[model samples]
Target chain A: MSELSHRLSISIPFENDKQASMARKTMAVDPVLKSNELLIKFNQEENKLICQFMGTSDRVIRVAISNVIDNVKTIIECFDEFDGKDDVQFEEKQETI
Target chain B: MTQDLVPTAHYESPSEPKGYDFIPGDGPHSTIGETTKISDIVINAGGQDRDTPSEAKDTALGQLRARLTTIQDKINIFLTNKMKEEKSSKELKDLEKKMLDEGVDEGSSDNE
Candidate 1:
């Protein structure tokens, strides 16, 4: 059996709530069977990941997360993504602490 | 941080809906007509300048009092709204965690 050990971290920056919400839905159906909602964190916070799932290898995790990101792009194509609101903010972030 | 710094030029005039006067919390909680109108800015014709030292001190004290009251009101509004948002965000986060955990458990079983 495969180790089933992996960690997938994805940071998607979008200008508004519509894009963020779309990103969440897209991640729910990742083809790699590791789809999970991207943690939507407020930009002000020091800790980016508001959620996480731990497993045994980074390769599997990366493939799963990449699938989610691709799905998010698909969602963006179908709908109006970000409006660039005055108060709205976005930041793509990832780092190993 | 530099990111938090808003361009001063962006606060030009009332032309921009998000002006310097714009409240930071969610949307305007003030009722229509409840706030002082810009058009109401007018110099009182009967108002006289304070010439004496005592009169100047009194005027200064009154101005300080008014400013303090305005600051207090803003702080109260901010704290109230912040508490509400915190409570709601916490509840939503908890729900998201439960759903995600269930999904992860199902995935583990699938691997089994």
Candidate 2:
């Protein structure tokens, strides 16, 4: 019997380090789908979140990559939502509380 | 994030017919071949034609920005709800502790 392996790496650039860090934190909390068959890693460098995945088959690798991409999208959306006008609103709400 | 990125325009090489001059026997009396006339036909050369127009590219970029805004709004709603839930849970815990302490205080006063 022989083992097949596949790997994928993707770098998502953000506007700033804060955004990248937030993305890294969001993605790091989620556990991998198939722990035995796939592995996922995330690293933050300046304004980019570097993602890597390894799997036993092409399907697993692709699935892992897509899942991470979705997470990154959510994180970017969060940045766009909170980084400007929303921050002032959030602070005002906190003060009222 | 992936959806927000705008793709640049792409072009493909224009398909032009190749023209060649066909000389019939090589002397001044030789008759020109039929294919030789193809050389006289003007053919525009150089540079590939754009597959997508500039207007189309602008529209696509606009659509991508719109979609990104929508996604951001959804995320904002989700985060707001999460914060509200957390605040309410914390308030509930504080109220429970206050009630417990007051109960103990009342019991001690009654005993004294």
- Which clashing pairs does model 1 show? A5-A55, A5-A56, A5-A57, A6-A55, A6-A56, A6-A57
List the TM values for chain B, per candidate. Answer: 0.39, 0.48
* Candidate 2, TM-score of its B chain: 0.48
Candidates in order, TM-scores: namely 0.26, 0.42
Q: What is the per-residue lDDT of model 2 for residues B1-112, given as tens digits with 9 covering 90 to 100?
A: 3333321111111111131111112121211122212233342454443321111123322333333333323333433454466578779999999999999999999999
Q: What fnat does each of the candidate structures reach?
A: 0.00, 0.00
**For this target, which candidate reaches the highest TM-score against the unseen true structure?**
2
Worst 10 residues of 1 chain A by lDDT: A42-51
Question: C-alpha displacement of A90 in model 1, angstroms?
Answer: 34
Q: State candidate 2's TM-score.
A: 0.42
RMSD, one per candidate, in order = 25.3, 30.6
